[model samples]
Target chain A: MAVPRELRQISDAVWELPVSWKPGMRVPARLYGTRDLVEHFDDGVFEQAANVATLPGIQKYSFCMPDGHWGYGFPIGGVAAFDPDEGVISPGGIGFDINCGMRLVATNLTCGEVEPHLHRLVDRLFERIPSGVGSTGFVKLDEDEFLDVVEQGSRWCLRNGYALPEDLELTEEQGCMEGADAAKVSHKAVQRGHNQIGTLGSGNHYLEVQVARKENIFNPGLARAFGITMPDQVVVMYHCGSRGFGHQVATDYLHVLLDVMERVYGIRIIDKELACAPFRSPQGQDYFSAMKCAVNMSFANRQVILHRVREVFSDVFGKSPDDLGIRQVYDVTHNTAKLEEHVIDGRRRRVLIHRKGSTRAFGPGMEGIPERYKPFGQPVIIGGSMETGSYLLAGVESGDQTFYSTAHGSGRVMSRHSARKKYQGKKLVREMQFRGIYVRTASLRGLAEEAGGAYKDIDAVARASELAGISTPVAKLTPIGNIKG
Target chain B: MPYTYLEEIAIADVAFEARADTREALFVEAGDALMNVMVEDLKSVRPLVRRSFHAQAEDLERLLFEYLQQFIFFKDAEQLLLRVSKVAITQETGVLGLTAEAAGEKIDPSRHDLNADVKAVTLHRFRVRNEPAGLIATVVLDI
Candidate 1:
């Protein structure tokens, strides 16, 4: 597909689409990427971004990051903010996997030490971590108890001995978002999620063991602050979300909002997935409260996974997690809409920013990050395909341009069906294993669809973010072992 | 099977168009497309257990959306890998209702060649259209 004809190039790293491109667009749409990246973007991405610009009360410009791709209502890696009183909340902006995010953990082990035990560790983690389709977590909760899990989030994990006190501090929103009312969540949501706390869902979700090579460390001081001290320090990173629970929450609200959006609020949407309700209206508030429940559920899910990861490390090395220096670096969400204060036209105003496939990269001295690392800004984890390396970045001061939002991952450039036809899963696994990366997966066909070549260059995306000043590179982590579901 | 995957529609998700001479057959093919998306081989999912359910909406588009969403719900909430074995659609004035009987067993990843977890059936250009000789529907499933 060719790039849209009317896209205006603002800079080598930024492009703008005027409101005149679409009838209902209330603001101009901006895209952050290199010319090559933006040019290769699917036409659907542009349509989705333009459609988002039409939402009522949308402030400034609607934006899509370098990793942006086609999505339901907004392009993946979309970022937009709206006035809390006048704007709206749409489940489309948050995505089906509510609070889908990345969590990184640091360990004192080195690559050489882990190399010999790599296969065993991967197998054990695969067995212990519940992966693949329809996999259930070890955590069991009845409907009544499940409500508490959604309400308390990682705090529930802490009480259940799955997390430490410091883990909460290192987490975005301190692991438990406020005003999450379980009562607002549906029974179906609880049933789908109650037993899925720690299970990694299938389709691009993965758990990997990575090494931080010295040559890849761009900012040693900030890297050390995020726990990359040794020359080839080993770390664990996993990507997942609230499981069936979050999907159900998003599904329920999308239908509910769609039923009343036009009849009640008179809000028209270009896409059915973009159905929304006014922020202050009863439907919107209910959705917000319910959305937080999914957010909290996902936070708790990752915390339990972190605990399982620590246990796996401890069991492999025959030492306690604390003895092995296993600690959480940071856990941050990508799919969420949260109320935040940002300066607009020289005045600080509170707005609800809906970041679909984008990360919150709060710069130095920002209020949301942990105080211990506030001087260096929040740690941003950018996960690449298992075949490629991932990066650890920091929020930059200039990120105020997009309200401190940055790309989430190396976005897809090819369709899964096409990728599957181009590469066989078994062959891809063999190739990756030969290159020093051990692999474990639930399905070979699923793995084939995730070949590194299917996505854009991660280096280019990171470089674009830096040039755009939305983020700053800190360190790069090379994968050694991977477990996918 | 009277369904084909639309690779170009939803790059990050899965989209398919199902067609049949009748609405019931169209619904069946649509569910098959959804089931096939989750499991690579539809035959890999044995009809060892049967489930009966109902989905009602005011329109055919919403009806299709509600009907296909049930597969995601079954997999997530009940861990069932089902295929629509029987379906009945009824129109009562402005309201439309669908009752379906599906069969499959609890998903065993080892036995089923799992492809991707279909997160939800999205409404991105979702539709059911009527033609002179048949009906056609387009559906997208978020993976």
Candidate 2:
């Protein structure tokens, strides 16, 4: 797709489409990426950005990060903020996988100490952690019990002896975001979530065991703050979301918003996928409250998965997780609509910040971050492809220019069908095994679709993120073993 | 083939266009297309469960949207793999009515080869059009 002629280059890594470029735009649309990255973006990014700019009470500009790509309503890696009182809340901006996020756990065991037992460890982890389509976890809750999990978030994990107290502090929003209304969630959604609490669902969701060496640390101080003290440290990462619970919530609300936007509110939507309601409206508040429940459910889900990971490690190494120093570094979400206070035009105003396929990168001294991480800033975990490496970045103080958001992953550049034509799952599995990265998946066709050739280069994305001033590099970790769902 | 797989618009997303002489056949074929994404064989499982669904919308677009969503809801809630056996569509003025009956059995991994889970039917590029041969419906599934 051709880049829109109206887009003007603001800097080597930034482009802008002025409000005049489109008829209904209330503000300009800004895109941040290296020149190469910008050229790789689909034209859908600009179209969605322009459409988002036309929404009511959008502050600053509609923004897209370096990894931005075509998505249903908002382009992946899109960011937009709207005033709580005057603006609207759109689930399309939040994505279907509500609160879809990443969590990093650091262990005292080094690569050298665990290498001889690597195969066994991977096998054990795969066995202990339920994954793949139609897979269920150990947590089977009734309607009342499921609602409790929704309301308590990770606190439910702590009470059920699945997590530690420190785990909550390192998690975003203390792992218990406020405003959850379980009653607002549907009975069908609850039933869908009843048995999926700790399972990793299929499609782009997985658990990877990586090794980070001290030599890879970009900022030694920040790395130490994140508990990366030694070279060749073994760390485990989980990338998942609220599962079917969140999907049903978004699906149900989209129907309501589509009807109310036209019949009751009389608001015109540029795209049916962008269905929404005014933030303060009864319909909007109800969706927000229900979305909070999905968010907490996801938090509790990951917390329980962490407990399972600890058990696998203990079983393999013959020691307790506490003695193994297996502690959570941080857990942050990418897909959400959060009500936060940010200084715009030198005044603190409450706004709903919607980040779709983008990570929240809060700079140092931001409220809600852990006290120990206050000076170092929040940890931003970017999961690269199965073959490429991942990175650990911190939010910069100057990140406020784009509402303090950054890219979530090395975004896909090729279509899945194109990828399947180029790579074979069996051959790719052999290649990964030769590269010392053990690969396990339930479906080979699904594996072929996720070939590393389908996505952009991680190093380039990390560099563009730093150059754009949204996040700063702290450490780089390479994968030793990966489990794909 | 009852349905033809459509070209993907974005990486990892799945879509299909179902066609039949009648609206009922189109709905049944659409269900088969959705279930095939999760399992390799459609005829391997027995009919252990039978379910019925009814939905109404102001237009055909919204009605098809609700119809596809019902299959996903059942898959997640009951662990059932369903194929729509019968469907009926009616219209009076602007209101559209849809009734569907589907039959399937539990998902047993040993017997059925499970594939990617179809999360939900997305609104992007979803449509129902009348072609020269028959009624054709297009759907994009969020996998």
Candidate 3:
């Protein structure tokens, strides 16, 4: 359990734990963090990342983002890509929450314009957005409609009059990932997702109205192009994913992969938590297909949520959504697997990339980027803990160091139990109010667990990613009103 | 003996540390604690069948993780609450060989106040060590 001494410091922001530090490791482990942040990592995270480096066909380095935390198999902020032919895919790499991600929307209305009705706006949003554990939304679909959601993703919302075409243009993969096979998903997973669409499941998921401040605007041109104006323009952001269905898919396949890893692949793992099968193997393929279904389901889930938000805004402002200019800035998934082409040791190769608690920060002009955002790099929405300031970043060329990936959110610094014990929910709410932030949630305990103090300093984490050349800061967004599930 | 809820993440862990003169008795006590965490009453349900598991691992820590993970898997997937009937472990060189028998019953949610859903057992702060008193195992789960 000792810290590896062989790590070579690449820079103040980067450290390299070489492959030679451990036997069987195929690649080095590259960690992105300041000295203080790196020191705070639980030693087991380094051990896990070293183990991930040993996986076949790992590219560049098994990279850990600054917000790294100990997780099953891979560290929470771990990023790894494997060659399609030689690499292996592990369900642990994607974690249990498939396609969990964040989305940011821009608004034409400025903070001054909405200040008079801020409380009413927040209240309406809270009521319209179903939240909390096991909460169900208004979207009730039959099996056939659900299948379309699994296959079409956000497109399903557009067809149902829940989203605009422009929103689809701003979403990654146009809000639907390809290769989803509903048949691959279990009936249990489908049942779990039936009433959960558009519902924000509890634990770290939230909807926030943010005020863009003058001091934090790093790219005025880009912000202006995205229709963000004035020092106090208000924008809404939320983080969520496919609910119970995603969890069930992950649970079912973790067992499937565990059995297959022993019987068919003959692979021995250091921890059962790291259970995996070859990407091309039948078991791996099946999980990937099912995972895609969950991804699409989440896309549709967010789309429906967007529709609900739009409805609330229209009702409050006495203006249509188009007039309010509540357009999606971008949506990106932080969890899930994708087949992507990356330059590996000088050659372009196709690999199945697993980004657990990492977000894709593809630079401007990347082919996979939706055409509308081709001029602007993919919008990276980094959700902070309920008490802190969330960030809007853009992928830059410097991200080539880590395959254009960055931290997903303000990572947990304390366990939920510890947070609840340390801070009373009522006191935390009052403190947020004093800071000009409004809060609402179904469970006070849930709110306490998600308090900003329970997480690492998001500003520092986002800055580390920017300093390390993985992502560039575009704007700093401070919350004025918030709702949690 | 009642199992103490030690800690939980998305992944949860309940443990009972006990001592006995024999290893079999210690394992039985551990099983009793595990079953207590899984459900409310141990005496209410009758064991319909006894299942045996034999596994070999390169290391003892991993062997312990696999053992607990297997119990969780069975409990969640099959609605079967397992009680360790017996256990035997042998160490030869660096490898450990284990044999165990477990009994299970259908799940009754009313009896089982499930605290948290454990996603996976993690190596974070994981430990399995020997003391003069007895064997000790501790783990941090990924909830």
Identify the leading candidate in terms of lDDT: 1
Specify the poorest-scoring 10-residue window by lDDT in model 3 chain A: A131-140
lDDT string for model 2 (A1-485, tens) is 77888889988778999999888999999998998888878878889999999888799999999988888788899999999888999999998899989999999999999888889888888877777776778887887999999988999899999889999999999898888999999998898887899988888888999998777889989999999989999999989999889999999999889889879987887999889999999999999999999999999989999999999999899999999999999999989999888999999888899999999999999997899999998999998888887899999898998888999998888776677678888899999999988988877777877888888998888999999899999999888888877
Candidate by candidate, in order, the iRMS in Å equals 0.9, 1.4, 6.5
Runs of candidate 3 exceeding 4 Å displacement: A1-3, B1-143
List, for all models, the DockQ compared with the true complex: 0.78, 0.69, 0.09
Candidate 2 per-residue lDDT, tens place, B6-41, comes to: 765655588888898887788888888888888878
The whole-model C-alpha lDDT of candidate 3 against the native structure comes to 0.78
Cα-based lDDT for every prediction: 0.91, 0.88, 0.78
Q: DockQ winner between 2 and 3, please give it.
A: 2
lDDT of 3 at A235: 92
Error of 2 at A24 (Å): 0.7
* Candidate order (DockQ): 1, 2, 3
Which docking class does model 2 fall in? medium
What is the overall TM-score of model 1 with all chains considered together? Answer: 0.98
Rank candidates, lDDT, best first.
1, 2, 3
Give the C-alpha miss distance for residue A376 in model 2, angstroms. Answer: 0.6
Name model 1 segments beyond 4 Å from true: none
Order of quality (TM-score): 1, 2, 3
How far is A459's C-alpha from truth in model 3 (Å)?
1.3
- First chain TM-score for all predictions: 0.99, 0.99, 0.98
